[model samples]
Target chain A: MEKCKKNRKLIWLTIYNELSSEQKSQLEIHLQACSDCQSDYEEALRLRRALDEKIQVAPTAAQLEASRAELHQRLLLLSQPRLQKSWFDKVWQIVSLDFAPSWRFATAVALLTFGVLIGNFYSRKAATEYNFYQQQISELLESNISNIESVTYDPVTRQVAIELNTLNDFTIQGNIEKPEIQQLLAHSIVVRYQNLSIRKKIPESD
Target chain B: MGNEEELLIRRAQRGNLKAFEDLVKRYDEKIMRLIFNMVSDAEDTRDIYQEVFLKAYQSITNFRFASEFYTWLYRIAVNTCINFRKRKTIVQHDSLDSYLDGNNDNWQILNTSEIRNPEEQLINKELSEQIQKSIDRLPARQKSVFVLKHYHGYKLSEIAVIMNCSEGTVKNYMFRAVQKLKISLQGYQQL
Candidate 1:
């Protein structure tokens, strides 16, 4: 039974004619003595015959010729230097390069740092120009002090009040729409209004 | 390798189109048949057939004569078919009857006068289809192994190289494929 078991496993290879002469002789001896092994061998032979004689499907000559012709045409095209690499090949080429991961990380970091530096420089430059314009507006407002009676600013409303001493002492009160007025108010808020009492005094005077 | 094949490979490597075409003509039939057996679809087989040679031609410059040209070509064929199978959902269809009938030459060769009776012909056709279905049901690796070993008559070692696996693994796949096929075709054994 053990022999039969082993022979049964080799029976398929035997039927397929894959065994060496020694193995074939051994299997033949086993088949002759064991009916079970004989039946298995016969069964395997039947299967092989079925596959070879009946189930064998081959490409027709016409099909083969057509395939060959098509391949020939394609090979002709490929014989020329490829004008374009496939996107996948391009990506693979890039990825297969000798660049190290550390190099990639460094490049990304450098770009990020460069971007941040650029952004910071522009922001600081804009702030400096703003401060310069505010200083000029405050100087201009100081020069026009002869035409003004009193200057009142409301921090909450962001409005400014100018009590003109011309004609009748009327007050001109509106939100600071002019850059000059905004600068003058911004100057007073930043410099002179360091103390809350002084800051509150301007709103109370109105 | 034969001196002729070596000369052909050398010429093909040097951008000799005629040498390349000769090489393709020599192997295209076997390659097409292998692809057809692997995929069991004529259209897909043709596409893979074209792709194999095209890829070989495009990358011929990289061929360093490390192995036989056939082995290298089979590697490309096997890999291409495996990838094609992986990328597409296999829709099993009963087109064997059409395939057999469409190729009357194969039909005549397979069905001689002794088995020409209508009933026996019908039974044989059905049995063949059952066998195909069994083969189709095998997993990809097992199917490739079985097709290469049984259909294409490749050696176990050759299958190993084509599949890029160990000989033991190829044998295991072949065993499993045979077992599955045996079980599947058990009903038609008496015929």
Candidate 2:
């Protein structure tokens, strides 16, 4: 049963006559004893004959000729060299007297140079304007230092001393969870510390 | 592979349009038949026919003479057809009855004068239609394999080369295609 089951699939190849000589002999031996396989083979052969009767429909000669002609035209176009302006035509266009080419070239260069000069002037002006705005912002930030008790700059040590006044004059030290201290520290960093040129400092008791 | 064909190929490779056209003429009929058998739609077949030759002409310079010119050409035709089938979203199912009723444009060509008896003609037409439908129902790869094998009479090895698959794989496809065709065509065997 196992052998017949496997041989059933080969029935197609057998009907198509694609089996090797040895396999064909083996299958022939199997077919002599196996009525079921024989019937399957017969069915496959019938199907093959039906498939063989299919008429190969060719395109009409007219269609073929039309396609050939179209393809030929397309191929001709593909093979043909591209149309280009001749060197004489290019030179004539460039040297044509309606507009003097040299004067046009000079005008183009002058315009480009003037455009570059104006672009450079505007860029420098914009940079200066940006610096001025930055300076104003720094001064504006400095004005928000109301809680800072005093700011002393030491030239010898190259340090700026910043003293802060608490609301109750009590030194409040805690974690970053303290909102007031966090706000004060943020303001000090953004305003005084960012702009000041300070290196090292030590608090002095007064 | 003939000396004359070789000369033509050389000339075609050298950009001789006449030589290329001659090559097209030599194989266009068979190629058209093969494509039409694979794709029953006349319009799609015509488009693929034109595309195959145009592609061959465009890429003639790349012909390295590694295989027969026809095999190389068949590769292009098969690939183009496969891609064309893939690009299409709707499958065009041609009804054989409608086609045989003189509605199809190619009906006149298919209905040759060989069969004078109307009854026999009808039977033959139905059988052919059944066969085509079976072939059409196959998956694309199996369809190509079956068409190339049975319709074109190409050997399995040759089919493998044209399909760019192993011979075993081609045989497997052929087996599955034939099995499907057998089951689909079981009722028509007595006729």
Chain B alone: TM-score in each candidate?
0.87, 0.87
**DockQ of each two-chain model:** 0.30, 0.32
TM-score of each: 0.63, 0.65
Candidate number with greatest lDDT? 2
Going through the candidates in order, state the TM-score of chain A alone for each one: 0.37, 0.39
Using TM-score as the measure, which candidate wins? 2
In the range B1-191, model 2's lDDT, one tens digit per residue, is 89999899999999999999999999998898888877787778878888899999989889888878888899899889888888987767455565455555543345365556778778887888788887878899999998888888888888888888898999889988888887888788673
lDDT of 2 by residue, A1-206 (tens): 99887787778766666788999999989999999898877877777777766655666666778888989889999999988989987767645533476677776676689899999999999788656645543554445343545545454444444454434332223334334435545677675556654333444645
Native-contact recovery for every candidate?
A: 0.36, 0.58
Task: Flag regions of model 2 displaced more than 4 Å.
Answer: A85-206, B93-116, B188-191
RMSD of 2: 18.0
In model 2, the clashing pairs are none
Candidate 1 predicts chain B with a TM-score of: 0.87
The digit string of per-residue lDDT tens for model 1 on A85-191 reads 68997667555542477677666676689899999999999798767656755555454333445567677887887564334444545567767666555654456
